[model samples]
Target chain A: MLDKTTRVNLLYDHYGALLTEKQRSFVELHYLEDLSLGEIAIQFGVSRQAVHDHLRRAVDQLEQYEAVLGLVSRHMRRRAVKRQLAEVIAGLPVDDDQQRRLLELVGELCEDGNGTGGGDGDV
Target chain B: MLDKTTRVNLLYDHYGALLTEKQRSFVELHYLEDLSLGEIAIQFGVSRQAVHDHLRRAVDQLEQYEAVLGLVSRHMRRRAVKRQLAEVIAGLPVDDDQQRRLLELVGELCEDGNGTGGGDGDV
Candidate 1:
């Protein structure tokens, strides 16, 4: 049986792109809907191992797609930076000048890529 | 030295929230900007091991966050489903009735989780 964490990760990695209609149904029933593999197998009229194999293959394909495209990677990075900026903003002492400067920096970082116009140098 | 795959995965998992400013900077320079660990260490005036440790800790934190909260997992699943839908649409033959039904189903799935109101049943 796949652990919840692994199943969730696999879904995250490929839920929209890598699965077929049948495979997608399998994963949704098994993971998001919290159905057992055996139940899914019964529903789909397949063996438990077949369901497991489909999920495994789907995850491998999704990982491969991510390896090539990197959209998920970029999104994750932006999220991390945003979270860090929020923390910084929240933790600042009550200095108006410092707060203004920090907020400006945060805005700059949060802006769309072209706004800064630096070639990764500022980073 | 971190493999590119693991580094990328780490960034995706925890890029914005879990890393400190310094840790975020280190990962960006190393992964996004393609800087070497030794170079980053030299620039930050720290040992290579320190950089490595920061990255390792950051990755661990990101993984922990994902384990607990699961935003990344949800995003990944949505992406995979979208990809599969695209493929199915592309591969279908030029039959109007089937095409119309498929398109409708696609629209429903792509909807913002409210319109059809079907629970895990539709899957």
Candidate 2:
């Protein structure tokens, strides 16, 4: 299982745009910027309670989106699968040109967490 | 670009759960079940305009979610990448056990669209 901060960061990457502007700001400030609740409250000119509420709601909303869509979970699974694939390729008896090329392809997909393939149009 | 029906179906797959019950029902009825708007409204005991409004809003919401998350887009790209990976493996000079195994792995990932990997736990 992923740690809370890492999980929230991954969730935010997948569903942050679905959040309200204030909620988005609060999460970015608190999580990404590593700001404390009091600091965020002071920065946003809101009470600490309000900031806390927004952060909690925003995180809850992110988790809710994950629960429904499962995009984040799928992404993690794909990454893991790609890693296993690379391991299998590496275990082949001979490390020839073909093996090297195949490993390169696996590396590309593994690095491309979103699977854009560097916009090569020939993935 | 995908056709309207295909695009809507893909979007619906990614974001259908985020929709309200009525919107979900209307979309499933119209798109998945091949029911007409008037038919849906009559079945639900609502006006045709109301059903149409719900469908329009629901599809719009799905598109909005895609715009933010891009899960559908990434999924298509990943599928394409897997296909290309398979082709590369097939074209290898030698047809050995390792080559066959690599192709099988690629085939597994390709078939598992949501990347669950058949619950094998090894993947």
Candidate 3:
């Protein structure tokens, strides 16, 4: 079974794509493989602090990658908006007029046309 | 313009969602805002090495987060697979028979059906 740290590192590496190979490996072994820092150090024949240092540096790199890209933020924002829209649709009162209006709004939001504002339209 | 370190850190924080507030801010200023180590030290009222230490630790945290959660990995994998598939479709010869086969495969891949294998079908 994968250790928590390694698994999390893998996800970050995959998404961030900015980590060094050594850093990625360190994360995988320590975090996903559930190996202790000592174990990793032993296996890699490095000091425990060295392993720790690498892990720490790797995290910084991942964070740096995200801050520059903003892809994750955009994705999360879109998800939040979609979730909010879903809630609004689900909570609408059963009046025919209200239902129709909600449906229309949803359709507008989901439309492929370029006329809608307040969206990240194609640049 | 955001510094390199700060921008990179923001992306990671937004995606990773595992960093401490201090770590995020440090990353934002250093990486995205392009502040120097010495500058950041003065601004944060910490030693240069202290800022470095914070940035390093923050990276470790972000990597640890990714290791535990495979969301980033999954997203990358999906992107890779999609890119490969797109390349294959784009490179196909103009033969009608091949076109039909390719279209069929694409349709199957895109279908919201339960029978297809080789996909991360909903569990």
What are the candidates' individual DockQ scores?
A: 0.02, 0.26, 0.02
Model 1 spans with C-alpha error above 4 angstroms: A1-123, B1-15, B91-123
Tell me the docking grade of candidate 1: incorrect
* Top candidate by lDDT: 2
- Chain B TM-score (each prediction, in order): 0.60, 0.80, 0.55
Model 3 alpha-carbon miss at residue B118, Å? 32
Residue B68 Cα positional deviation in candidate 2, in Å, after optimal superposition: 1.2
Candidate 1's TM-score: 0.35
Whole-model Cα lDDT of every candidate shown, in order? 0.52, 0.71, 0.51
Question: Per-residue CA lDDT of candidate 2, range A1-123, in tens?
Answer: 888888888887767767777787888888888999999999889999999999998898778766766667766776777777778877765558868778776654544243111222110
Interface RMSD of each: 21.4, 8.7, 18.4
**Across residues A22-88, which tens digit of lDDT does each residue of candidate 1 receive?**
6557666766687888898898899999988987775665454345433344445555555654564
Docking quality tier of candidate 2?
A: acceptable
Q: Residue-wise lDDT of candidate 1 within B25-113, one digit each (tens)? A: 77668766778889999999999999999877766655544454343444445555655555544554435665455445444333222
- Classify candidate 3 by CAPRI docking class: incorrect
Reference-based TM-score of each model: 0.35, 0.82, 0.34
